[model samples]
Target chain A: MPSSKKAKSVRAATLSDVGREAGVSAMAASAVLNGARTSSRISPETRERIEEAALRLQYRPNAAARALANRRMDTIGVATVFESRELNPYFLEVFNGILETAALHEQNTTVFDWQRGAAKLPGWCDGRIDGLILIAPTLTSEAAKVLPGHTPFVAIHANVELPNVVNIETDEERGAYEVVRFLISQGHKRILHVSGVAGLVGSDRRLRGYKRALASAHIGLDNALIIPAGFCSDDGYRAMRSWLQQHAGELLPHAVFCVSDGVATGCLEALSEVGLRVPDDISVAGFDDTLSARTTLPQLTTVRQPLRAMGNRAVEVLLDRIHRQNTGDKQLTEKSIVFPVALVTRASVGAPPAIKRVVPSRR
Target chain B: MPSSKKAKSVRAATLSDVGREAGVSAMAASAVLNGARTSSRISPETRERIEEAALRLQYRPNAAARALANRRMDTIGVATVFESRELNPYFLEVFNGILETAALHEQNTTVFDWQRGAAKLPGWCDGRIDGLILIAPTLTSEAAKVLPGHTPFVAIHANVELPNVVNIETDEERGAYEVVRFLISQGHKRILHVSGVAGLVGSDRRLRGYKRALASAHIGLDNALIIPAGFCSDDGYRAMRSWLQQHAGELLPHAVFCVSDGVATGCLEALSEVGLRVPDDISVAGFDDTLSARTTLPQLTTVRQPLRAMGNRAVEVLLDRIHRQNTGDKQLTEKSIVFPVALVTRASVGAPPAIKRVVPSRR
Candidate 1:
C-alpha cells in the first residue's frame, strides 16, 4: 500500500509549474518565491496568487540552484582522523556543540576522514563546501603551506601555527598544573605521570606542567615514574600493565596523573587486575572530563577542557571569516581563541595512603 | 608569518593552465585528466604529457563542475535527532562505521539534525546530495506518504515499513528474551524491566520479549515492576531513584533489565547512592552494548545489535538505490534487512543475592 502511494507521487514542483498555476512568468514567480529585490514591483494580488500556488504545490527551493545563484553552499566541512577505527568521546562532545550551533545557523555539517596528513585538504576545496573545520590536525609545515586560500578554515588544537587559520584551544598547561598541584597538596610525593604521545603540542604542554608542579613542591622528578602512554584506554592499559610488570615488588607511586580519562580507565583496569584498590592504595587523576570520566566506577577526578564550547566557537569564527571574504572585508580577526579549563574533583582521587604500597605481581 | 605565506600563494590551477603547459587543447586535457570515454582517441604520449602537466600545476578538478557535468554530487546525507544536547554513544558507533565505509567509496557524509519529524525530509532532496540515510526515524503514516520520490532513502531502525525504502534493523525482541532468560538461569526470579518510551517499536519489542520470557517460565508479570523510563541515562536514574523512594521498605528486585547501556549506568548510580553494590546486592543488565558498557567499573551485561555493521549496510543499500535510479534499472531491493542480535555477558549480571535485600533510605 505504501509502495502504491509512492508510485502515485510525482516529482517536486518547480518554479515554472508554480508560475503556470499562478498565470505569471517564471521570472516573476522566482522573484516572489525567493524574496528577490524586484519582488516589490509585482502587484500585491499577483504576489498572493504566486504564494498560494507555491503552498498548494509544496514547493521547496533546490539547494543546487540556490547555491549557484548565491555562490554559497551553506555547508561546513569537518576533517578529523580516527585512531584505531574509533572516534573518541572527545570528538563526540565537540561535534555535539558544532551540530547545535550549525543547526541554529541553518547550515549543513559534512564530515571527512583525514587519514594522516593535510595533503588531501586542497582537493576538498572544490566549491562543494563554503568552509572547513580541522579538528586537532597534526600538519607538517610543508603540508600547511599548500592549503588553498579560497575556502575558509578553522582548526581546533592545531599542532602547528597555520597561516591565517584561527586556532581554538584550551589552557591545557594550566589545567595540568592545577590538577598536579592538587595531587601534591594531598601529600603525594612520588607521583607517576602517564603521558600522551610525545611531540604533540598538547602532550608537551601537559608534560611541562607535570614537571613544573613537582619542581615547585621541591620533589625530585624520577625518570622511571613517567610512562609513555597514548590517548586511548588500550594504550593506557598496556602502558600501566607493562610498568607494573617491570617494577614488580618496587614501591608504587603515591598517585598517578593520566593524560586522559580513557588512559585513566585503562590504568584503573590494570590496578584492579593486580588486586590494588584505587585511593586506598594509590590516588588516580585524569585530564579531559569526557563522558568516560563519569562512566568509571569511582569517577575520574579530571580537568575539564570545555571542548563543547570550543566546538561552538569554531563555527562562529569560521562563519565570521566566510562573511568577511564574501563582503571583501580585510579587517583582521582574532588568530587564537583560548578557553579556560577547570579541575573536577571526583571519588577517584583522595589523599595518599599512610602506608606506602608496593607493586604486586599480576594474577 | 603564516599570513605572509598565505598572501603569496596563488589561486589553484585550472584545466586551461594544464592544457597550456602541455601544449594541447583544453578539451584534450579534460579527456585525459577525467579519463573520459573520448580519452582513448588521444595518443598515450599526449595523455602522459597532459598528466605530467597536471602534476606540475597541482590541478584538481572542481567538485561543483564535475557534479554539474555528471548529474551527481558524490555526497550522502544523514538525518538523526539529538537528545538533551548530547549525541548518544549509539549514534557514535554507527557513525564511525558510516565514516569508514564512506571514505572507502570516496563519498562525503553530510549530517542534518532532524528535530523529530519526517515532514522536513522532502525538503532535503535538493540535488545537493545523491541519497539520504534516516537513523531511527519515527514517521507518521501521513508524513510517510509524502516522501520525495527523486531521492533514494535507507532507514536504520525505522519504526514503520516505508514504501520502496530499505529498512535495516536488528532482532531486538530475541536479544531481550535471551538476556532475561540468562538472568532467570542465574536464579533471579523477580526482575524489574526499565522500558523505553511506550509507543516506540524498539521499546514495545523489548517489553514483549520480557513478558514472553516470564510467561514461558510460568511467572506472572508484575505491572508495578515495569517502570516507564525513556531511553537516556537521566531517565533511568530518575525512574529508578523515584521507584526506590516510593517503596523504601519493600524488598528489591533480584535483577534489573534496562533498555539501554545509558539507562543501566543511571541505574548503577542510583543503586550506588542507596549503598547497594551491583551484582553483589542486586544484578543489573542493559540492552545495546555501547561504549558506555565498558566504561563502567563492572562492565554491563547487555545485547549487541551490530549497529556499526548496520550503518555500513545502510550506506551500501542507499548507494545501490542511487545507482539503480540513475541507470534506470528497476530491480527491487530487499524491503527489510534484519540483522541478528547476540548476548554479551559482562560483569553486571550475576546470581541473585543469598538473602532478600530491602531498599534503603536515600542518604
Candidate 2:
C-alpha cells in the first residue's frame, strides 16, 4: 500500500494548491483567502485571481491554521460531573440551553468529564478551547486555588467561591421556603424534609428555608422528621424505606418535601411499595421540576428552577469574561448572578387526608 | 490599561522558552519534549537539560501545535439532532457510553448540532476532528452521496445507507416481536402499536415485528389500532389523546406498545388524564429501556437495546477505522455491527382488565 491516506480520493485544497493555481505565492494566497490585514496591500486584480482560484478549487480554511493565525479556536468547553454514572435530567436541561446559545454564537461545544477533587482541570487549559463553563462544580478551596489563571471560567451553582469566577445560581432558599409555605397553606402541620447531601451550600440553604417556613407557620421543627438523603433517586428510596422500617407504626408526616426531583421519584416508589398513594395517604413535593416531576402518576407539585435559562446565562457570562480577558480588562464586574425560582402546583399536592395516616409496616 | 492579556500572571512556558532556558534550539526542545523521531539525534546531556527546564517551567504542549505536527486532532466529533428542542433519554444513555470510552482513550469529544437534510455536514470535514459519529441521522440519498470521503464515518441507527460508513444497529425487529409476544402472553388480544415517524428504518422494522408477532399468534391485523406517532413524548401524548377521542364509546385496546420509552411516558400521562390506570385499566409497554422507563409512576415494561454498549462499540470501531485510514489501508471491513435486545419486565405490563373497558367521552 502507498504511504498516502488520500491515495483513493481527492484531498481538500490547501493554500499552497490555491496559490499555485492562481500563479502566486502561498503567503499572498493566504492573505487574500483569509482576509488578513495584509490583503489590503495586494492589487485588486491579484486578489480577484486568488479568490477565483480558491472558489474553483473548493478551498476551505483549516481550523488549526486559522487558530494559529487568530489565536481563537472558537470552541467552548463544558466540564460537568455525571451523577450515578449518568447525566441526569437537570444537567440535560441546562446543557440544552448552553448548547443553544453557544451554537447561536457559532462556537463549538466540547464536553469534559470532571471527577470531583481531580487536579486534571489545569491540563484542559491548553489552547484547544477559548473559554470554559463549569456546571455545578464542587471544588475544595485548595483545588480552586490551582485553577489556571490564564483561562477565564464561569461556573453554574459552584459549591465554593473561587477567585475571579462568576457563579450562576438560583434562589433555592426562596424556592424551598415558598414550596414549604404552600404545603403549610394546604393545612399540613407535620412535613417531612428529604435534604440533599449534608454540608453542601445548596443543601444548607434549603434546610434553612425549611426551618424558617415551619417557624413562620408556628409549626415547631421536629428534628426526627428530617431525613438526610443524597441528590440521587436511590438515596431518596433507601432513606424513605429505612425510615419507614425504623419508625413502623409511627405517625407519618402530612407531606414529604424532597430536595430534588430525582430523590422525589425514589420517595414515591418507596411509598407505593408499602401500598401507600401520593397526595392521598401523604402529600409529596420535590425541588427542581425536572422531566420526572411531570411523568409521575399524580404528577409532582414542585419548585421550578430556571435551569435552562441559567445555563444560557452561564455561556453569555463566560463569553463576556473571555472578551474582557482578550481586551486586557481584569476588573471583576459581577461575582454571582441569581435567578428566581417558582412553585408549580400540580396533582401531587392536595388537602391532607381526612384520617391521620401511620407509617405502614414492612410486608 | 496595557494591551497584554497576561500582564497580571505568568504566561505558560512555550517550547521556545524551554529551549532558551536549556541553551538549545527550539527545534531540539520540540523533538525532546514531544518525543518525536528526531529526539534520538540529540545527546543525552542536551535531552536532560531540556527535560529539567520543561519540569521547572511546568510546560504543557499546545493542542493546536501537536495536531499540526502529527496531522491528527485526537478528537472525535459527535453530530446529533435534538428532538423537541431537548435531548431525549435515549441520546443521553448512548452519549454517556461514548464519553466514557472516548475519555478512556484520551480523546476529546465535541458535539455539533445536525439539522436534518442540511448540507452543513460537508463543511465539518475541515480537519478539526479525526473521525465523526452520527447519532441516528435521517439523511436523504443525495445528502449521503455528498459525504466527504476523506474522513472516516460511523453512524448509529442511520436512516439511509451511506457509502463507506459503518452503521451500528440493534435488533429492533426482534425486540419489538418479543415485547408484543409478552403482551400476548399476558392475555392481550387487541394490541395498539404507536409507531415512530413513517418510512424510517427503525419504525418500519418495529412495525414489521409487531405484524409478524400478530401473524404467528393467528390474530388478524387491525389498521385502526396502529397509531402513527413520532419518537418524542409530546408526539405520543397527542397521538394517544386524539385516538382516544376518535374512538370514544368504543372498546379500548388491551395494551399499547409504544415505539420508545419517552412515548410510553406520554401514553401513561394521557391515560392518567382520562382516569385510566396502567396495568390495571390498560397495559402499556415501551421500547429502548431508557432512564425514563424506571422513573415513571408504574415504571415501564420495555425493551432494552443495550444503547450504552452500542455507543462504546461505535467509538471502538471508529478508532479502528481512523487507525487504518492513517496507515493508508482503504480496505473495508465490517459494514454493520448488530447488538441484541431483550425484554425487561417492570410494573407497566400486566394481564388485561377483567371487564371490557370503553374509551370515555372527553369532558
Candidate 3:
C-alpha cells in the first residue's frame, strides 16, 4: 500500500521546513501555523503567506513524526465485542458523534472489533493508540488483567470495573427512577420491570433505580413482577410473551418499564399478540431512545442517553489524553464525567385505565 | 502502528515452509492444508500429522505473501454509501452475511464508507485489498472514473452499472410481480404503488413488474395510483401524508404496495394518524424484508432480497476474482448475479375489507 519507492525517507511536513522556506524561525512558524503558543502572534500579511505556502505544498502534519516528537498519536482506539451481536442505533449515534469530534480536533480514530476474548487484548498495548475506549466490554477480571498500564482507558458501560479504567457511564438509576415515577404518577401501581442481564453494571443500575423509585413512591417492590429479559428486542418479546401465557387471567401491570428500546419493542409485540393495546390497555415505557423507538407505531416514551454527544465527548477526552501522554505527563487522575438523561414524551405512555386493563389474545 | 524493526522482515508465512517442515511437496501441502480440491484426498495419517505441524507452528499463511505468490490479498473491500442518508436494516443484513462468508474463507474484510466520496478512495486501493465490493453506490459516471483499475470491482445494488465491473443484484421485477399478484389475488384491483426514487433501477424494475402483473391479470395500470416516493421512512411518510391531504375525500386504493419496509413503516404511521386500520380499511405490502418489517406491530408481508446472502456471496466472489487477477487470469466471464426473492407472509398484508379506505384531514 506504500506507493512511494522511498517509503522510509518520505516524511510528513514539519514546522522547521516551513520556517526555512518562509525565512522565519521554526518556533515562530509553528506558532503562526498551529496557533500553539498563546503568547506568540504573527502579522496578518505573514500569516496569509504562510497559510498559502502550506496549502500549495499540500502540507500534512506527519502523524508519526508528531508522535515521535510529542509522544502523542492523537489517536484513540475503541475496542468492543460487537461483531455478532446486533449493534443497534444507539451505538451508531454515539460513534457518529465521536467521529465528528475526533475529526474536528485533527485526531485519528481506530476501531477494533474484539470478536476474540479479552485474553488476546494485552497485545493492543504495542504503543499504537494513545488512549483506548472499551464499549460495553464483558470481560472477566482474569482476562482484563491483560490490559497494559502504559495507556489510559475509558470504558462505556463496562460490565466489571477494571482497577485502572475510568468508567464513563450514564446515571441509569436516576433516569429509570424518574421514568418509573412518571408512570406511577399516572396511578399505575402494578408496574412491570423487564430487566436486562441481572449482574451487568448498566442492568443493575437500572434495576436499583427502578426499585428506589418504587420505594420512594410507597409502592411495593414486587419481586415476581421483575422479568429477566435482555438488551435485544427478541429477548423482551419472549420474556413478555412467556409471562402473558403463564399468567393468562391475571391482572396486567398498569405500565411496563423495559430495560432498553429493543426489549420495549419486543414487549409491545407480545402485548399486541395478546390483543393488548399500548397505553389504552397497559402503558409501556422504554430506555435508550434509539431509532427503533421512533420507528415503532406508538413511538416510545423513553430515556434519552445522548449517545452521540457522549461519543463525541469520548473522542475529545481520549485525544486530549493521548496528546498529554505524548507530552510525557501520564497524570492518572481519576476523572468521571456524567451526562444528564432526559425523558422523551411519546405516544406510547398515557394515564392508567380505571380498571386492571385486559384484552383478548390475537391467536 | 508498526511497533518493531521486524516489520521489514515481517513477511507472511508461506505454504512452502509448512510443506518443508512436514516433509511434503508445496502442492501436496496446499491440497492437504488449504483443503482446496476438496474432492481429492490425502492419506489420513499424513493429514493428521500435517495438521498437527501446522497448529504447532501457529501458521497463518501470510495474506500479503499469498496474495503476491498467487496474486490475491484474500481480502475484499466493501464500499457503502449508508452513512447519513440510508441507515436501513437492509444494509445490516447484507453486511452480516458478508462477514459470515469472509470469516469462513479466512479472508479479511474492510468496510469503506463511500459517503466520504471519491476523493478519499484512491488512497484506500494501494494494494491493501485485492478486489472491491460496492454496496448501493450512487456514483455518477464522473465519480466512477476515479476508481482504481488495478483491483477488480464488484457491486451490489449499484445505482448505475459501471463498465467492466461485475454487478450483483436481485430480480426486483419478479419480486414486484409476485407481491402485486398477491395483492391482486386479494381483489385489490385499485392498488397503489408507493415507489422508490424515480429513475433508479430498483424503481423501474418494481414498476415494470407491477404493470406486468396487473396486465397478466387483465387489470389496467392506474397512473393515478402510482405514487412517487424515496427510500427513507420520512419520504414515505411525507409522500403518503401528502397524498392523503390531496385525496382527502376520494376513495382510497384497495391496497398499497410500498417499495421498502421503511416506506411501509411510514405508510402505517400515516394510516394510523387518520384512524384507518390496515386490512380493515385497506391492505399494505412492502419490499425488502428488513428487520423493521418484523419490528412493526403487525409484521409486514414483504419481498425478501436475501441481502445478507448477497453480502456473503459478494465477499467470496470478490476474493475469487482477486485470486484470479493475481494469478494473471484476468477474465471474468459473468458480470452479474441475481438472487431469487422470497415472499414472507406476515400480519401486515391481509384480505382487503369491504369498506373504501379514506383518510379524513382536519382541514
Residue pairs in candidate 3 whose N, alpha carbon or C atoms collide under 3 angstroms: A71-A326, B67-B72, B71-B326
> TM per model?
0.91, 0.94, 0.78
> What tens digits encode model 1's per-residue C-alpha lDDT throughout A309-346?
89899999889888887766545578899999999999
Q: Write the per-residue lDDT of candidate 2 for residues B1-363, one digit (tens) a residue.
A: 646546554557899999999999888999899875778988999999999999998888888877876778889999888546445777787888899899989898988878655477877778888899999999888889998888899999998888899999999999999999999999998999999998999999999999999998999999999999988888888889888888888888999999988888889988888888888989999999888888897999999998888889999999999999877776779888899999999999989987665667455
Stretches > 4 Å off in candidate 1: A1-25, A35-46, A83-85, A185-187, A248-250, A327-332, B1-27, B35-38, B217-220, B246-250, B328-332
* Model 2 misplacement above 4 A: A1-9, A23-32, A36-49, B1-9, B23-28, B36-49
Candidate 2 lDDT over A61-107, as tens digits, reads: 88877776667787899998865644588788888888888988878
User: Which predicted model would earn the best DockQ?
Assistant: 2
Model 1 chain B: weakest 10-residue lDDT segment is: B1-10
Chain A, model 2: TM? 0.91
Q: What ordering of candidates by TM-score runs from best to worst? A: 2, 1, 3
Looking only at chain B, model 3 earns a TM-score of 0.82
- Model 3 gets an lDDT of 0.75
DockQ of 3: 0.13
